[model samples]
Target: MILVGAVVVLLCWLLGFWLLWHIPAPGEFRRRAGRAPAALAVPESIPLSVSVVIPARNEERNLPCLLQSLAEQTRKPDEVIVVDDHSEDATAAVAARLGARVVRAPDLPSGWMGKPWACWVGANAATGSLLVFLDADTTLSPEGLENLVAEYRVQGGMLSVQPYHVTLRAYEQVAAGLNITLMMGMNVFTPLGDRLAPSGAFGPCVVCSRADYFATGGHKAVRSAILEDSFLGRVFA
Candidate 1:
């Protein structure tokens, strides 16, 4: 019985190591370091038009910070649209106060989720070559939008960013397990990363070409999906 238990323990250890080995480190993606202004400058070429779309449902408290961060971006979006998804709060008012175009999302239709529907409304109203979808709670760095644009230009497909979480409450720390599991399960830490399955996207921040978004039917294709972001990633891929 002792020998059998030892063998079982060894197998478990080997399995754990194998799983860890396949996971990819976040640093491997070269996400840091924005391109220099000089390197980013071009000779009188028309810059790509980018529109930011935010879906808000009772996001009155979060909108202000996110909008402020967006306003400070090195590469500003041509337009910012916020879709108020039937929020009883001042979500629309807050967005308007911050100079964002606000669209009141229509009542939820049959077989549709709130977020995807709101996003679809925003996407339809956007008039830019690139569409950046951001969650209301997300705050960006000054160079965040610039980096996203640069990365998209190079990658020429959907780009999703897993925002660095900032926790203030003790309970928030407990979410680390879920975060780690998500990364590992989605193969974000694996050698193939998103390429292997195109199975995951950071719901807080997603960027893609307007044409590509529409070509994949935007959020409409995933209207009822609870995991709309992940479904969209697969569609874009």
Candidate 2:
């Protein structure tokens, strides 16, 4: 029994040591990113029109907060459109009341999911040079839209950002598990980072030029995908 216990302890110690040595600390990722390329840099004076497109289904309660945040933005959207995905709730009414143009998402096609279809419809309707696709539940900070546009002006490509989630109640704290799972799924902190092609993108918030969106085929390219964000990211890559 003593010999068997000794062997188990040795194995566990080795496994722990292996993981400790290989997993990356999140901050280390910034160090790994080298200088930006000259080709990606754009002049500061360039002007681009921005549109905020939100796809919603049964989000009447949450939609107002987002629109309110949008209204409070230091850098306003040229236009804000909400795509109502056949919600039983009063989503369209609430959106129009809050000063957002409401558009009805057409019926789900044979090959597309609700979100991607709504997004596709919204994109086609948008008149801006830049498109910001944001989830209905998300609320931006005052400088949020400005910062996004500024960053896009510098980098000039599809940009994805993970929103910091806040839990208002103890019960909501259980959502930390999903947060942990997402960090682990990123593969950035693991040995698999080099071997696997990264498809990890924050689907809840994304910004890109309308031209790049169309060039990559946009959401329509990944219409039938179960995880359309991953597929769309892969397509853009």
Best by lDDT: 1
lDDT of 2: 0.81
- Candidate 1 per-residue lDDT over residues 1-237, each given as its tens digit: 999999999997775554455543333333422444333322225368999999999999999999999999999889999999999999999999999999999889999999999999999999998899999999999999998887666556788887888989999988877766566556544445445665677788999888889888979989999989878877876
Tens digit of per-residue lDDT, candidate 2, span 1-237: 999999999997775454333543323332344424333344555678999999999999999999999999999999999999999999999999999999999899998988899999999999998999999999999999998887666556677667778889999988876765555565444555656555566788889989999998999998988777767777776
- Candidate 1 deviant stretches above 4 angstroms: 1-46, 192-195
Model 1 per-residue lDDT at 195: 52
Candidate 2 segments whose C-alpha is farther than 4 A from its true place: 1-33, 36-40, 187-197
In model 2, what is the error at residue 66, expressed in angstroms? 0.3
In terms of TM-score, how similar is model 1 to the real structure?
Answer: 0.84
How much lDDT does each candidate structure score? 0.82, 0.81
